[model samples]
Target: MDLELFLQQLANAISLGSLYALLAIGYTMVYGILRLINFAHGDIFMFGTYMAFYMMTSFLLPWGAAFFIAIILTIAFGVLVEKAAYKPLRNSPRMSIMISAIGASFLIENLAIVVFGGRPKSLPVPDLFNRIIHIGNVSVVSITFITPIITMVALAVLMFIVNKTKTGMAMRAVSKDYEAARLMGIDVNFIITFTFAIGSALAAIGGIMWGLKYPSLLPLMGVMPGLKCFIAAVIGGIGDIRGAVIGGFILGLIEIMLIAVFPELTGYRDAFAFVLLIVILLVKPTGIMGKNIAEKV
Candidate 1:
């Protein structure tokens, strides 16, 4: 490939990888605390984009305000989902909880269809995001440059929260041993809710960015990205934040580069995630950054 073409593709990969990292962080965080994959997480992403879309198009809100409101709504919805669906099944069988999660996902998707209509809508991109820059022989959009910076800042803040604060300590305690944390006076429920809120917020940010890059809105849009982010999380060591970011970058790069090298495989791009996932599971189920913990006999 030509140097300019390669540079453009690299920019695309970085932008896509940053988004995957955002979504993967949410999955990893929830799995860390609840040990359950929030199947509805992707739907939450869809919800965020729609919220921003309506806020801008219908309510005539500024993009910045709409984005902020969408994040807040996503966080609220996530907490509500936990309280209404997952909370009730918390002490029940794991199967029951998993089933509930699936149900919630379907419910959200259908509701989105009913509410947002089945048709795909064009997302309104801000002029700022569309601004283009030329670097050497390559052209790049503003969002492409902004995404990695945002991802790095978010990652740094998240790491500080996870490693430095009291809440982070509580999260660690709960993840390690929920009953033990409760016995020690930790509010396990609150921590779980907080974790969900954080995860949902990250998902919202990702969804907004996704919409900016792709500019299409559909209720089911989250399905593929959600699954891919989950794959990214698993590849990065499911519960490890740093691992999720690394895995996202790796997956994004591979997926982009694959298409670059062989244009004929454009239709098979989505399949790449699953293919990589299966290989990772077979070779190292624990993932690159994952630590294998021995189960107590």
Candidate 2:
């Protein structure tokens, strides 16, 4: 490929990777704290985008206000899901919690279809996102640049919260042993709910970005992206934040480059993630940054 084309593809890859990383971080954070996969997370993503869409179209709010409100609502929804679906099953077997998560996912998707209607709706793109930028022979949307910067800033803030604060210490302790942390005076339930709130916020931001990039919305839109981000989390080492970012970038690059190099394989783009997942699981089931842990008896 020519240099310009390659650069264009690279920009697309980075943008897509940023979205994946944002979503994957949510997955990693929840798993890190609760040892539970929030399968409903992608639906939360869909909910956020729909909320923003309605805020803009139905409520006639500006993009900034719409996005802010949508994120807040999404966070609340996520916490509710935690309390209603996962919290009660926490002391139960892991399998039971997993099933609950799946059921929650289905419930949200069906509800979305009923509420948002099954028809695909177009997101009204803001001028800022739609504006085109030129660099030599390559041109790309402004969102391409904005996405990575947003991802980096969000990651930095999250790292600070996770590494440099008392809350972080409590979170780490809880992750190590919930009962032990509770014994040590940490509010374990609060920590889990806080983690969900953060995860939901990220999902909301990612969903907004996804809508700007793709513009078309469907009830099932989050399904593929959600699964792909989950794979990204697993590939990066599910509980490690840095690993999730690395895995997301790697997945994005491979998918974009594969399609660019061989246009015929465009149809198989989704398959690439699954193939990578299988390879990672076989080669390093614990993931690149994941340390093997003894199963709790």
Q: Name the lDDT of candidate 1.
A: 0.94
Candidate 2 lands at a TM-score of 0.99
Clashing pairs in 2: none
Each candidate's clash count: 0, 0
Task: Evaluate candidate 1 by giving its C-alpha RMSD to the native, one decimal.
Answer: 1.1
| Model 2 lDDT, residue 265, Cα | 95
- Tens-digit per-residue lDDT, 169-193, candidate 1: 9999999988899999999999999
Model 1: residues with Cα > 4 Å off, grouped in runs:
294-297
Q: Once superposed on the true structure, which residue ranges of model 2 sit more than 4 Å away at CA?
A: none
lDDT by residue (tens digit), candidate 2, 221-286: 999999999999999999999999988988899999999999999999999999999999999998
All candidates' lDDT scores?
Answer: 0.94, 0.95
Q: What TM-score, to 2 decimals, does candidate 1 have? A: 0.98
lDDT for position 111 in model 2: 92
